[model samples]
Target: MRVQLKHPARLALALAFGFITASAAAAQEPTPEPQPAPAPAPEPAPAPEEPAPQDPAPEKCEVVIDAAGVPINAEPVTVKASFSRDIGQPARAQVASESGVRVLSAEPDAETPLTFTLTLDTSAGNAGDWAIALEGEGGACEGTISVLPASAPPSR
Candidate 1:
């Protein structure tokens, strides 16, 4: 079973047969299985944003002191103190004197004039005037109250 390619026609046929066999072998050879395209690199996460700045609130203001006067009474009597403007909420009342008179209680109303009905006890206080002050969350006002001797009883 020996074949010779000495003639021109036999040489051409041999070359064509060799080329076809090479092609067939190449086609049958297992090509590297296409690797799944590497999953695209995961995209980077986005950054968080900062909040906008805000303005600060205004400060508490002082109110006007229109009038501060006590009408009457010194023996556990309530007195009213009127203001000209808003004074927030009346927190408390303070009283001072050169004698024994003092304030028993203080109550604030939520209406105009900013009235403070203060109970003043003058039983153990001397007959004189005392300083009365009203303090609130926003402002303060001060005035004076007089304590005097009661009138004597007439003869029966």
Candidate 2:
């Protein structure tokens, strides 16, 4: 068959090819998608566990001591102190004298209630009106000690 290239027909063919090429290009390109909103942040988890109970506070205890009125002249004086359940630990007792005497030793009761034998240094002149003190695990107890002078001979 004999072919004829007319101006209108050529223009029409070109336009058709352009449309096809544009459509093919568009089909090959990827389409943009609408992004989903970010998921709401999860609420913080509840606290791990409950705390344990605490022990009750200790009660005030009564402390007492007794000794002979007779004075014994010695380098290391011996005075006895007694403690009961009313009193706490035996280690807290502190013995002192008004004369600023040194405490050589404090012997705690091994059995039964807590008793202490406070040894003092006579060199410090720690005799007459000495003050004995007791202390608990807490602070010092009220009116701890009283070291009276040795018993004197009756006057004629």
Candidate 3:
């Protein structure tokens, strides 16, 4: 059938009819089947963050020396050294100073004050100080010793 819009009244009627027809067709188009709300799109999972690295524990040790006098002028002084904990066996042991000196020997003991013998540098003059540093698996520790020239003879 042919539809024609001739008069104003007919044109209005034709426009209304076309609009209603389009709406009816859209409404009848299967009602969209009542979809299940699309399951909320499954909310994408969050990405995992990388973990941070850790540092190793610090080691600890101690060193000490004992002598007849603060200023070790004598030939030999009993040296003692220890660690924060047991170091299994002796670690690197040495006696050092700005003045030349030497360690006779190191004797290890189960406890602190591991005794040793230190011989002063024959060439070292009076009034020089040196540090005794002991290092091992545990770590390191330092102590100080002084060298002094023999006292002057009795005053007149």
Candidate 4:
């Protein structure tokens, strides 16, 4: 025997069946392929470059005699000289004395505030004025040194 349903129940059943049919139909249809995400907008071009700042020109190299004219004897005499710029190499100090004063050693100091030392052999030289000449790669200085005569010994 056929079963009889109430009008409300029949209506509810028909709606449920319709929804299920629609869902099945949607599932059977082919889905569109996902598109790649849009490429990120290109970065703005970099700003134009500016020229770098330049350094000031270097000062002309020079040498100056700070002090001289020390008394000469068997001992060594020291003369001090300064350079406006680094000599980069040791300078040559030449001592020319009318009485034959000779330069025993000439050497530049190690660090900045550049300086030189000149040791003179006064034993061979007589009492007179000595010409001091300092020559370097970039500069030179000229000066004079004086030597005093040996004092006479007291009579016994």
Best by TM-score: 4
lDDT accuracy of residue 146 in candidate 3: 62
lDDT of every predicted structure (CA atoms) = 0.63, 0.59, 0.56, 0.70
Candidate scoring better on TM-score of 3 and 4: 4
Local lDDT at 27 for model 2: 100
Q: Provide the TM-score for each candidate, comma-separated.
A: 0.45, 0.40, 0.44, 0.46
What does candidate 3's lDDT look like per residue over 16-76, in tens digits? 9999999999988875556565555677789897676576565544555555333434455
In candidate 2, what are the lDDT values of residues 11-52, reduced to their tens digit? 799999999999999999999999999999999999999777
Superposed Cα deviation of residue 99, candidate 4 (Å): 3.4
Q: Could you tell me which residue pairs clash in candidate 2?
A: 71-150, 132-145
lDDT string, candidate 4, 81-141, tens digits = 6766665455577667476778778787666357776677777777767666676776665
Backbone clashes counted, model 2: 2
Model 1 weakest lDDT span, ten residues long? 62-71
Query: What is the full ranking by TM-score, best candidate first?
Result: 4, 1, 3, 2
Task: Look at candidate 2 and tell me the lDDT of residue 136.
Answer: 57
Candidate 1 TM-score versus the reference: 0.45
lDDT of 1 by residue, 1-109 (tens): 8976678998898889999999999999999988887888888898888677686554433322233433334447665666555566767766675646666776765
Off by over 4 Å in 3: 1-55, 67-74, 110-126, 137-139, 153-156
